[model samples]
Target: MKPFRRRSLLAAGFSAILSVQHVLAIQLDLQSTDSIKAAAKTLAGDMVSYYTGYRPGDVPGNLPSPYYWWEAGAMFGALVDYWYFTGDDTYNAITTQALLHQVGPDKDFMPPNQTKTEGNDDQAFWAMAALSAAENKFPDPPEDQPQWLALAQAVFNTQAARWDTTSCGGGLKWQIFAFNTGYNYKNTISNGCFFNMASRLAVYTGNQTYADWAVRMWDWCSAIGLRDAQYNFFDGSDDNLNCSQLDHIQWTYNAGTFLVGAANMYNFTGGSQEWADRLNGIIGNLKLFLKNNVVYEQACEPVGTCNVDQRSFKAYLARWMAATAVKAPFTYSLLKPILEASATAAAAVCTGGVNGTSCGLKWTEGTFDGSIGVGEQMSALEVIQSNLIDIVSGPVSQDSGGTSKGDPNAGTSSDIGPSDLNVGEVTTADKAGAAILTVLLIFFVAGGAWWMVT
Candidate 1:
């Protein structure tokens, strides 16, 4: 063979091998969309059962009370999304029931005091997100739905009112009671949730203030929170340095929340090319982090370089990555591999006995051997399933509808009385309180267990 021809053949052979490897790594049976749907359905069902059965109240016994609320809200939101995509009324009914149980007339809305739980701001984000999903699904405005809107608005106001311009360079305070105490610091997760909720509220109310807050929060994150040089996804504090020293100590939820927030902003703003470019950059970095086969080990920082070994970060990353793929513009071919890999990895973690239907994956590390926490499982499944829905339904046209605005009356609801504003102390000694405490403890242990295992 001629030297030039030989070289071309060699290059072609190498490219073929690479393509085969990529296909094998993904391990998706393209012919088995039914299997994928079934797996997602089972996972969603298990998650709803776990949250409703194990963690029923907002009290700190096992997991911190605030954590439970956050997870519950997130799970409900995901379930609502799932219903939206799959047209599964079961998921919808379960999610509505769960939200009513948590935020309905008789439930404790905030976490107990002395638990060191961050304020219910995270729940506010979840509540607002879920409400948005509910509204999107059922166009007819509920007569009593005004109360739900009022509750979310009250939470948003409380969060906005607690914003601190000092120390952290102007971001929402993490914990309301610990304002400026310096013990509880400003972190990306809180701000991400704040931005996400604010953006949603802005759309719902048709108000620009909430939209402005969302943009400002994004600016704060991009400017101060992100450690671009070292590949750190978010800062633990607003005043932190830009160096990537924190890269080794990455948190899955932090990255996921930030990406979702960014995606939400992009969706609301009618597809800014800059936002799309930034998301692509982040997506590239994230995929590079996943070069290693193990999800948990891929992003281990200071202790190990990125993409090293098995770690629990995959659950959170998978959920967020799926969220990004679903909401943002991306080629189906690019997303198909990721969706398959994420779903497969999630399935491997199922502790609920993977007989195709009843088994569920553990969202965090310490979940009961057979349990899948509501938030983790629901978010993960929602991300994958929602993307699948979009893929099947066809790409969303940029001009389909302009970004929805936040509710105008979101901040000034007189119906949110004084009682709704108070975040009482944690007292779990009573029977009802003990039950809440037990559930919280279980979630906490599961989260701690996942953290340790990862």
Candidate 2:
């Protein structure tokens, strides 16, 4: 009886393991274009299912609660790539409408509704989406609507004006408005977005000035230790501490952001060794986020501590890595296999939810992690569609039959006046006067606080 029971227990355990291992339901034949497009289409459709932004009474460009505005912009950006790669026009109309509606009066991404909650990083995500549209030659808006390249330039101009030398020597603040919680923090994402846009714009317009800004932003980030000697990009630092120490938590999106920007610089410089070295430095350290060649959120995925935002980070990494391959073809051999492994793993976990294909956060497990949302879906869609990278047409520039228009000074308001703007030039007297004004302001604030206490 004891011998029979032991054999039965072993059989049951084997059967249980087999049952939990989900079959690969997403049929992706990487070798065949038809097969790849079909798989990506289904995944994109499934992703769009969670988006209620276009529904009656819902805001057009904003994802529902728990998902932030920046992500919705990102989703549209992914859909633009989807259309570019797969020729699927299913999501284009709504994508265009959402983008146009959110351009705000300044033509930058800072809509009035998001003023209280929007950070510099938040606005940059939207600008990046618009830039993607221009690069992909996504259909231009009707003649009256804001042009895609101009919108991106507007964001670049506004952010350039906000570069804060007051804290951490130099870097953009995390938040746009003073009342926001992270206003005092200088973050990699904000600065990286600026760098990314600058590099891409440099490539698109053949503009030396944009390239210079890209170099400046990269130098500033490295000097400040946001990027360490090992190429591990840390999160952000407290301006209160003068950025002496970083947050030290590495996020996949931060690394991805810098990687794509560096790749673009490589293309802009006609394959400069400096940018090539930077790219290698970044990818060398990126292995920490990959498990079995599959991309996962390193910081929070393992511990199951990823909040709503962190869950979607791998999507950016996957998409940007694909872009990096296009900008610098040498990276294709390195990034392609990783992208293929990740896409396959990402597709396998889509066996959850009522549709039997809701994506989960962890792609390495090959089974649904039981989580579902816009992030998971976006991650899946990006990795899966990105498999078509090598076959699709690469991005174009103004010199290469591109048609998107741009304005160098799109977002600068005339009302601010030249004297108030410190971006261009400042004499010694200007610095001395600013220092005196700052001292007087501090004294008055202290005096006001003392009076209130008394």
Candidate 3:
């Protein structure tokens, strides 16, 4: 009877262990790719509706006027890429319509007044790339293709005309607004965007001028961006009073854009160790900024006292980090642990419910409910779903046929079923772990107190 009881106990323990392992291994299919595609489609549909029927100067979702240019440009690029990868004609049609709306008579650009800034030139890059790609894909070009290309060319020409070598070590001014403000500071974000756009433009149009601009811009940024002693980079301009350096001296987006810009330049100009070194430096600083299992901005200090505003920036940081992890060399190994942690955290939060609808981490309490106006869903989506994994895993080199071995959906989770446990239960587990640690510390303190008293 005693032997039988022991055997039963052992069997129960083994079963418990197996159950735990099963939970750990269970990857919830968030339908991430599908979700991203759906979101992109929804956004594109909104753009089409706004452009075709809405009142003049009307915008979607009450977004500020300054953001419209970049937002539309980015959405256009994303939709274009989605269409390219999935061959979804719906996305293609919407992008074409949206681009056509911006094209005008005599093939001159009629950029909505809202998008007039040269700083907003990055949007044109994305827009042009998508439109040019669409024209290439469909041999029967749209009537508006020439108009669109001409518009893009004009915008590029205007921006290139503004590039002055007199100030800030020979780079483009940050923006027209900055120029007006007398804030003619050279910035990493602007220069990086310049490099990215120029490189892509060079590739698409086969213009060595674009390629030259990209290389010159990248070389300028790399030389000025890095801080040798700290092994980090700044956002540009040494004016510490510029609010660009609030707390942490390092930022994920700055690092990410620079790294990506470098990678894109390398793609066009062939590989360079200088670019590789710059990318690695950004990655190194970013890795150092990760603390308490969370990526924080190193540019901000007194980490614990930092305001909740850090949440939004951190989301951007995560997205950039994930992106960098996938794109930069020798960085994937470092990214795996962080990605797994983020995935696990997201899964833990998303567990339970019939359709698993409530599992997402809300940046704030009322953003989704239309209260308090504190939501930015796209940032969350960008961080969670964008192909950062591809950067880390590295893409298979394409042969002459333009085929590569990297599968975007490879190793993705297929299980989308609801979890047996609720989010409350997950919260309880976290609280319980914290409580245990607190009690242990208290006990140690009490023991020390007693010894001193004796």
What TM-score does each of the candidates earn? 0.65, 0.86, 0.56
Q: Give the clash total for candidate 2.
A: 0
lDDT of 3 by residue, 1-454 (tens): 6999999999999787655544432143334655444433432343333232122333221234324444455445444444543345775654554444433222323332322243534444444444334332422224424433344455555445556555445665554433223235555555565665565455445567777887787666545543343445565663333323322245555555555555555555555676666666666666655554444345442333333233234444554455445445455676656644543343333322222222223322211221111112223334444433442223222222222122222112321111311123225675567667645743554344233222
lDDT of 3 at 183: 34
Q: Which numbered prediction scores highest in TM-score against the true structure?
A: 2
Answer with 1 or 3, whichever has the higher TM-score.
1
| Tens digit of per-residue lDDT, candidate 2, span 314-347 | 8899889999999999988989998999988988
* Overall local distance difference test of candidate 2: 0.84
lDDT of 1 at 170: 67
What are the runs in model 1 whose C-alpha is more than 4 Å off? 1-33, 53-67, 104-121, 131-135, 138-141, 147-154, 179-183, 201-207, 227-231, 238-248, 292-320, 331-336, 348-376, 391-406, 411-454
Q: Give the CA lDDT, 0 to 100, for residue 290 in model 3.
A: 59
lDDT of 1 by residue, 16-113 (tens): 76555333221223347655566567667665555432333322122232234455565556665565555667755445444443442222233333
**What TM-score does model 1 achieve against the real structure?**
0.65
Task: Give lDDT per model, in order.
Answer: 0.50, 0.84, 0.44
Error of 1 at 178 (Å): 2.1
**What order do candidates take by lDDT, descending?**
2, 1, 3
